[model samples]
Target chain A: MDFLTILNNSAAEILSPSTAAFALATIGLNVHFGYSGLLNFGQAAFMAVGAYAFAIFTMQVDPTATLGWPMWLSFVVAVLVAIVAAVAFALVLGIPTLRLRGDYLAIVTIAAAEIIRFTVRTSDYSAVTGGSQGLRGQDYKGDITGLNPLTGTTYGFGPWTGTAYDTWIRILAWTLVVVALILVWLLMRSPWGRVIKGIREDEDAVRSLGKNVYSYKMQALVLGGVLGGLAGIMYVLPRAVQPDNFATAMTFYIWTALLLGGAATVFGPLLGSILFWVLLAFTGGMLSGLQQIGAFGDMSGTQAGQLRFVLVGVALMLLVIFRPQGILGNKKELSFHV
Target chain B: MSETTTDGTAPTATHPLVDGEVAPGCKKVDPIVVADGVIRQFGGLTAVDVEHVEIPRGAITALIGPNGAGKTTFFNLLTGFDRPNKGSWSFEGQSLAHVPSHKVARRGMVRTFQLTKSLGRLTVLQNMLLGARDQRGESFFAALVRPLWRAQEQSNTEKADSLLARFKLDTKREDYAASLSGGQRKLLEMARALMSDPTLVMLDEPMAGVNPALTQSLLDHVKGLKDDGMTVLFVEHDMHMVRHISDWVIVMAEGRIVAEGPPETIMQNQAVVDAYLGAHHDTDLGTLTNQQVAQIHEAAEEEVPVGLEASATETTTTDAPAEPGATAHDEEGKR
Candidate 1:
């Protein structure tokens, strides 16, 4: 492809429905790990909940296969299911571990996520989940596209501009992001947010203030999880619902995005997601070009791709060690002493 | 053998005549919190073992003792941070024996920490807002509808701001709590505790790391809690501050109350003296045992002028005459 084509494709990838989904997912992660300080490694479970719920309802459960229920209703139901699933997970994990120190909660959550993944992939549930082959025909593009409010044809002056579908998803995804960010901002500004932060800092002190530390923590967990699940539902909107799609890598990517932007800030996750994808695209494209030019004797394309993660990992480690507070995260936010 | 028999029979014979058969008790008053046979053990060590203790209503009560005296543990038990091994306590007549920490706060009882717990990353105002956890729209559905909770949230912010202003933290409202000085953080914590609109406020070492300049202000703020009809109970080591602000005092040593009385009377009690000042003062309880303690009590009663030296110092200067410890203050201050 030409330079302009390469750049345009890269831009499309960065602004695609998939990117939007990941961005939303990262935003949810921001709520859990960044804002509430919950080390939830099962964020992908929420995404799976959303994807599977939406897929199952439309594909198998609903009376109609092709012309299913209203997309909005389906979206709502899927989100609700994801939230319930998240809350259930949180209760199971939080009940036993919230009383203990922080690391136990992290371990339990990660394990719960693993269990959830394995359960969904089992032979018994394969009929519904499609197991390794995974469920397909979850594309809501045509149905959702019909509902679009756009009245005019797409206008593009140059190669940089994209088609109607790209614009639609971009607008919708960003809209969701903006609304979510605003709600988070407002909640953080409120008295309730202060109590949550207090719990984060010193739960015992907050408890002494006649505040219910556990209740607040539970609320934080549920709220963040629900948001994460919502992001999950949004994630599968344009893609096929598959088990591997909601793998552990998704969680790590979201964490990377969140850290890159700034964990606790309002715009941090959004910016981080955009920057993360942009950098990944540029690196992959450059590495491919180098390989095509025979920069190395026999460096495989897969090796080049994996190197991107290594670079990002090193950057993340360095960031955490030297400046744990990300680009937008406040240094003060990092006072949890260990 | 006859003399030993006389010694034992003498006390028994004198008990009825001297009216010392029954132990005296403080006049019964409304208790903010009452712990009955409370006991908490960690591993093999019993951290708190209180037979009975009552925090008087609408008064400042100081829970004082030396280090490892289980004061913090008692605070934890009372607030539901930890469960007692065998005990029952109540706040405002409600049994809080098994209530959780958050539920304790909802029951109109709140507490501060010995180590300040201001959310370092959060702004001071945000920290205050957390204090209003119960006052907001807690329902998930209710939270999404901004208008339903906005007015209430706005009002809460306004309330938090007013509290910040009252505590003279208005200027630091936008500043991160971690940026505050140790004293300011203490003020922020106290101010945040008030956000819950609690009826009883428990402070754990409110003056531990406070500067002398801000110490009196903190004391006055605690006193203000009682003036506003809220019960104030605090753990403090500063005896002067304790005696000045505390209407009632409960002295703890080794996880048990050794003495409980009015601050004035408590200072004179032999048990209180031994628990607080130590056995070193036992030498003064000689031929004039009662008289010297009475003299010390009378001297302590004459409050030294405000901004003047402490009564303990003035007494050492005026009464000790030729003792080496008489110059103890001057020597220490010079060093």
Candidate 2:
């Protein structure tokens, strides 16, 4: 029932690596749904691929994995593997479906992401994926923490404080977010962005103009999926590569983050992710605190936890109803349709 | 009738467009696009089934057909947007069969859609710039480096600015295209197509949904294409537009080229008049009284198909599409 602790924890989420990871995923989704108008409903699948690939490479899942590689080599190769796998997945999903329409891609992507989650969680792959148990955070933590150049044990001021290792991950994650922001901004500002946006509004128009709508859509899918893979890598850096964490709901959370901020803007994802995490933490903390103080009557801790999602549903409806273009979207230009 | 409806801006011979006798699938003196055995089907419906058609070079040719004669489908096939069942088309003598739409555009043939596809979210300038071909910045990796595409982008922007001004859309350059009226959207779509600098520009019903006030300017813009030494092919329902600007006219009915000749000849051809245009084409549908409509309907009852009656009725009264509506209204008045 400690309000101070709840407030402090909620504030701490603003700079957390998880928030950064969510921002990264939202940024990638922005590239897909916001700019290219590709409705990718399976962003969680990309995160799964990146997380599992990076972890499996680091853990040396079996003897057949890249043998005798150093930790840094494993990490780098793991990232590359994530990127390649994401691109491959994008191609698999895009080649047949991108030509169909936005909804078809959404359907295929959601199915593909769910398949990835189920396959990884199945007992058949328990030897490598750890099944429902998931790999321990300690196993992957060593590689990244060992590479941390910062010597001091504790870092940052006030409630923003973290261990040297945590600070290192946060720094790296935020750096990626910044780099992704710049990349999106640069691309969107260029003539390439003009074509991508054109495809978003009308692919046929872009096609008639001779810009290869299919190719542009594929590129956008691959580009966004690669970023999603990178986000996955960063997401699991501090946590276990849990299969359950990358459920369909994970993809939706990323979408919520994207829409909450503004899908097509440069810093909208970052701002949204931070705000989402902060508000989520605040709401969850407040609900749990209220439950503990008997405000919920006989409601259990789990039921109290479920109430925050109801709030999310309400928030999403309000967002769509009031500001479909989102916080940073231009009211005149970027209104949501479908 | 004049041999060429082309205005006094420049002098060009009219009959120089056709090579042989005026007929369906006739040869052009210099054909920019030649299609052989182009066929497209959707279930039982053969949308486009052209045997042999040649688009004349450096001239404005109008493709005129009734509603379902597959004019847009033919345009789609030629532009490589949609594939034909078993035909080959060459744009500027380069075989464009199975080529992707963008490549078809790169090979110097570009098109516009029947329904204006102006990128509503983009500014007018952005929509125009997207039409330019072979930009270094359009590539994904090269776009990251501003220096690689900045000069080209600048020049493309300038080109786009000029086109917008020419289309009288310069004032709306900074505005989102969604804010534009229906006519402006059509103009923007055409201007955007011109950005590619194509040798052959195919405009699919460029006048559809356009305001009549802007139609003349749009007509001038299409003429301007021929003036710039580019071949202009357009699909339009307006016969006046076809007769006023087109050097040649290719008539399609039931997915086949029914006739091809100078605009003057196509207008005179008996089969062309019967298949489309109709015998009463000179009589304004709107001006016809109910008695006049009934008289025309009774006289042409055996010749005109039920489809043409619906279309004729559709033209006369926008809301009441059938004689049943007129009869029902008469019953209401009697009651």
Evaluate all candidate structures by whole-model CA lDDT and list the values in order: 0.73, 0.86
Question: Candidate 2, residue A5: CA error in Å?
Answer: 1.5
* Candidate 2: tens digits of C-alpha lDDT, residues A1-338: 99999999999999999999989899999999999999999998998888888787667642223365566666677678888888998899999998897899988998999899999999998988999988888876666776789999899987799988889999999999999999999999988888999999998888887787888899999999999999998999877889999998999888988889988888888888888889899999999999999999999999999999999989999998899878987787644232
Weakest 10 consecutive residues of candidate 2 chain B by summed lDDT: B5-14
Encode model 2's per-residue lDDT on B1-335: one tens digit a residue: 35544332122323566675556887888888899999999988999999999998888999998889999899988888888889998887889999988888888888888888888888888889999989999999999999999899899989999989999999999988888898998999889888888899888888888888999998999999899999999999998899899988888998999877677656666668867767576766567689998988797876668778867775675455366776666567679
Give residue B49's error in model 2 in angstroms.
2.1
Interface RMSD of each: 3.1, 1.9
lDDT of 1 by residue, B30-144 (tens): 6678788999999999889998777768788888887888888998899887899998988878899998777888888888888888778777877777777555455544555
Residue B22 error, candidate 1, Å = 10
List the TM-score for candidate 2's chain B: 0.79
- What DockQ do the predictions score, one after another? 0.27, 0.54
For each candidate, give the TM-score of chain B: 0.75, 0.79
How high is the TM-score of chain B in model 1? 0.75
The lDDT, on a scale of 0 to 1, for candidate 1 is 0.73
Clashing pairs in 1: A191-B129, A194-B130, A195-B130, A208-B111, A210-B105, A211-B102, A212-B102
